[model samples]
Target: MTGEELGRDEENTAVAGPVDADGSAEIGELIGRLSGDDDLDRETRGRLLGRLARLLGQSARKAGAAGVARGKWLTDLLVAAAPHIPIRDLETLRAHHHGLIGEELADSVVRVASNGTTAVGAAGGALAAVEFVAPPLLLTAPAQLAAETLVIAAIEVKMIAELHAVYQVRVDGTGTARGAAFLTSWARQRGVNPLESGSLTSALGSAAKSALRKRLLKTLGRSMSTMGPFLTGAAAGAALNRAATKKLAEHVRKDLRGGADPIKPLPGGYPSVGPADKP
Candidate 1:
């Protein structure tokens, strides 16, 4: 074939290539270098990490608020279904991280079940719950918001944990795990229980690590599109949150079936576990 004809054929082939999972063309090598590079200047790396953290925090908070709203709805649904859901204690809830973690976790789970990757399933379940209850937000704004925030925080915790795993960050019981512990303690001070508060940290950390690796592989599979580091990070966070939330909802569903109580009592006040508990 003539050189020009060969060139045209190649160009056309490129144009016809399949799109990446995130809708962007592949920029695998670049993304790998950026994500994997540890030798980059500290300032640059710090900035990138900070930016991602901020985005995640903001997304988490928004998601948390949404979760609180959903939680209120779910609580009402539970009550309607059994008329004896056992009123969740505000004092107990407060002990669980200022209500932030609880709100985020609830929100995250609802989002996963409602408008997330498994939206169909979530929506079905949510609708069923709604049919039974009058809807929480319309009834109690603060409680609803708190529940949503708890769910979102749970997803974020999982996401961060997952990222730490992918990066091979030593969990020597230090770093993120420690941070999570501290956060848990902080929540307890406000009256939230460890079961709920600790769950958020664990969920977020696990989700982040798992999602980061999955997203990395997904980014690698495409051919033409390139995802900037920032975008990739965000996408990874979002995906991880969605997955974690779904898992959490499944757990919740199981608990509900088992007649689990909404809030559990913590062993002690704040920081239930200590440094020695680190593994």
Candidate 2:
């Protein structure tokens, strides 16, 4: 090859080298960004979600190419990505709910988060239904499923983080450290252990790994169950997602406390609704 051609090739390789150089770290950063409490506009929020989904899709693709079973690949991905899922900080969450505090703030967080997860489930179901009939779209199902899995996981992670905020539990760490703390909580489906050290390591251990795998399998099963005929699948998908999110939240709440009543609602008989509550 000519010298000029060789130089151009080297430049291209240099540019592509760093993109996948630290795959896990990059994935964690993306998750952190999505789960963070940044005040992004609607369009920007949508774009970040899309980016995270695409990264997940690529992760699945790479694993499949390496001969990993689809189910196992997905479980592994979810476990690795969980800690990085961006969870909103208490200040941002409280601000969004305006005058809500304690149980009332917690209620608003779950309500909004459940709505978001349910929407993702419905959309994923509809997409699956479409892929069922369209030959041209069949190849997209796995990627779509992978994306859906990450998005739903992120939502649940957020729920876990915010619930801790509600209970006045302090999770120690900033940035990824904080994210990892809650990731462990989500994997175990329980509250954070304030006394534990290096929660990120614990989260990646065999016990946490097993827990996450089981949880993801259950979620995947629910998604797969909605793969019937189109209309039926869509309806089932929505209801299934909504119910599942509520169920998960209730269980986590109980684990946080012995199924106690919601922190008594704030005084004045009602919460001052914030802008977040508006459509």
Scored by lDDT, the top model is 2
lDDT of each structure?
0.28, 0.56
Error of 1 at 267 (Å): 29
Give the number of the best model, judged by TM-score: 2
Residue lDDT tens for model 2, 1-279: 100100012223110122245365566566555444455454564455455556666766667665334356665655455544545556767777796887788788888777766666656666667778998867666566556666677778778777876776655433333444454456556665444332222223444445556676667767765566685765676687778777777777775664643221112211111122111
**What TM-score does candidate 1 reach?**
0.22
Query: What's the C-alpha lDDT at position 208 in model 1?
Result: 29
Q: Mark the 10 consecutive residues where model 2 has the least summed lDDT.
A: 1-10
- Looking at model 1, residue 142 earns an lDDT score of 29
Model 1 score (lDDT):
0.28
